[model samples]
Target: MGLAAASSEHAPVAACGFAEATAVLRRLTADDLERVNETILDRMRSRAPMIPELAGHLLRAGGKRIRPMLTLAAARLFGYRGLEHVKLAAAVELIHGATLLHDDVVDGSALRRGAQTANVIWGNKESVLVGDYIFSRAFELMVSAGDLKVLQILSAASGVIAEGEVLQLSTQNNLDATFEMYLAVIEAKTAALFAAAAEAGAVIAGCSEEDAEALRRYGADLGVAYQLVDDALDYSGAEDALGKRVGDDFREGKMTLPVVLALARAEGEETAFWRRVIAEGRQDADDFDRARAIMRRAGAIEDTIGCARRYAETALASLQDVRGAKDEACLRALADLAAASTRRSN
Candidate 1:
């Protein structure tokens, strides 16, 4: 569905660009985010020195803190006044950091967010161990929150993320990978944490079960849109904009949505070319360019963006029943941000 035009009362702020939405959220939750950041630093400390060293490396690396910000923003939307959301937001950041460390090791990635990956500098063993340490810290914070429901949501998300990773491993280079399979993998790998973060926020705020569920659905759809855009960017985005080289997924033979779509539209020789390069891992220097050309010919990137747009619309719709004018407006801005994220260059 096309975005509804904002009424005149909201016209000045109606164009909820990603940066503007983030700015609004930051303004609304500045003090809370400060506490969350402080908590993250304190909890990341360990006598093991290397643990802190490695964990701090990625923590200091520039990420938008979007996931944790979601938690903070969601809590604010419900007028939560207690300090529990602070710990929960920090826990969400820890969980996200741990996943990044582990994901680098699994992907054998050399760079992240325009910096050397912890695994690249510290070695795989250190990366894995440090990731585990951070995960433990996350759970400790969750326990400190003393909310059993929060624990259940986050812990389950952790497991689902692992399962998603393993599922992606199983599907790698498999040309026969289907759209449903890709969606399932992204839901588990990426959306699960987002769902947990938003749900935990609403739960802590004492929102009704229905409202909490709406936040969870919003997060899940937003995450899928985010990942779809990321995947498309891997093939088409500038290196500086992406914080990594373009075609990284193509180089790794990962079966992203664009590749899946391109393969589906491949003709005789084009089919053989994809199978040889992807399934057989026979890529050459020129293969990435060729892959891009084919994907463009198939309109894969546009199709992927279209898919992301649909999810973004769904995310916006999920917030319809949310109460409170201010809360609904903030949530609507967030949903708009998710949709706008798909169109960003970086």
Candidate 2:
């Protein structure tokens, strides 16, 4: 189906985006998520003297907590009642936090969730150390589950994530970044953690290898869709709604999909405009407007959205092997939710 048709057909079935995610997530109670979150926070707080303060600063900022929720919800859907789910959820959240700390430093981000970033409040050295503290605490918390498989899975994903970040940095201004390269970087940098989250849920729940693998695929595809839309929104999203400065990637000389497509279609002055923006990193408000116009003229936004829809479809298809009746429905809804979220304002 085309984008409009897909949106219309899936609207009722998927519950749009946040509504669907909220409904599926409701399977796990607030107390359940909060209990796990508190434990995670407490463990971080209990860390040795000065490090706790640094870690505490970022933790207090608070986020949507979507990663851990994915893990907890998957475990609950599979009938897992053990406390291990709590630890695993905390582990995912901590891992996520560590990445953000590092990302803020790399991106020179001053604010996050309407608060000063650790790097901005504290020094980069302190932010990096506190990030390490969270990583260590996450591993320590993981030991309570006693699953070496989970540890190995998370470890490998973490390595790939770091490598992907470096790769993205390397390709920052090189407008020649291929579509394949873009997908690979996203899978490693962003999707790997999502894959680990869902796979760990199944592992802790004693799910079969097949079912666990299926969930892993689901998370990976969902993450791809999530990040693709994120990059797309950087061009079109309102600054206030995005919760970050707009056109940041372009200003940073980062060549995202929108810019890539615009470059490919550019001719004459348009091509030189892209070169100045991407190569020189010279951008202003009018530059952002012109870039958006260029992207629209080149059909990059629509193309990128189409790719996101494909990933969402793949995510939905991956659930075919899952056995439970609700599992399939919820997973399908989750896929639709992912797809619908691409067009969201926030």
Best by lDDT: 1
lDDT of 2: 0.77
What candidate 1 gets wrong by more than 4 Å, as runs, is 1-13, 324-329
Best-matching candidate per TM-score: 1
**What's the TM-score of every candidate structure?**
0.94, 0.90
Each model's C-alpha lDDT? 0.84, 0.77
Candidate 1 similarity to native, TM-score? 0.94
Q: Look at candidate 1 and tell me the lDDT of residue 147.
A: 90
Count of backbone collisions in candidate 2: 0
